[model samples]
Target: MLGIGIVLSIFGLGFFCWLLFTLAVYALPFLAGLTAGLAALQSGAGVIGGLVVGFFAGGATLALGQMAFATTRKPVIRIIIGLLYAVPATVAGYQVSFALAGIGMSSGGWQTAFAVIGAVLSGCTAFSRMTLLVPPPDGQGTGGAYSLADERLHDQRH
Candidate 1:
């Protein structure tokens, strides 16, 4: 039992750290794009403004995804909401970039590429943070399990 506990604990912690790392990685570029977009907005870059807004909006929505995860115990439902919010954000980001570059929305692959990247970054980062913060079902997996142990132990007794 002790070994199992330790193993589970270690895996949980590792998973949490990985999540944090992923958040940071995804956040950096998204933030950079957001900042650039805002700057563009200031300079009358309407298209850029759109890009910035789309990126930040997606990021904000990603945070919402986190909230959903924290409040809901159902993984499938959480994922659906997260994806629904995030996927549109990504698509919007791509469209904004094309508009910013003065390219038509029908510009084909380039716009799509931007959208895909934005969505991937936002979704991965947000999901990482959300999953870490939320306790898993079955009471077996969650980030910060070590810190939650005292409470979990108490709950176990009840």
Candidate 2:
């Protein structure tokens, strides 16, 4: 019975990780594209312009989507929160790249910076999600130590 339980728990954790990975894969692109589109439109670019916007927007979207779903039940709220979290990171990445590569930093430099920032921001999102999913103290049972409760409940007496 104990062996079966352990096996089942491992399977469940594997499934959850797969689900998380799938969600992240889909969400980030959408967010980045959306933001980019809005930016292009606001700047008076044409349809082609919006496409460019959407590309970036999709990445931003994905990052936020991951973070948003990490802890909350509300998809809308999660997306909003995710967006709030991703935008600044994105901006900072662009700025830092420009600064590091010099005032006239090449586009490649900006791209590199964006990638680094995006990765860091995504990590933050993952951390937040883990935080949310972790059970509360009451649910943690025995604080990871061998508890008197466990001994009383399941210890086999000789």
Q: For each candidate, what TM-score against the reference?
A: 0.35, 0.28
Model 1: which residue pairs collide? none
C-alpha lDDT of all candidate models, in order: 0.58, 0.56
Best by lDDT: 1
RMSD (Å) per prediction: 15.2, 18.5
TM-score of 2: 0.28
The number of the candidate with the highest TM-score is 1
Per-residue CA lDDT of model 1 for 4-114, tens digit only, reads 987887786556445533454244336545676777677886985669675876566556656776788666897876555455434444444344333324666766665
lDDT of 1 at 108: 60
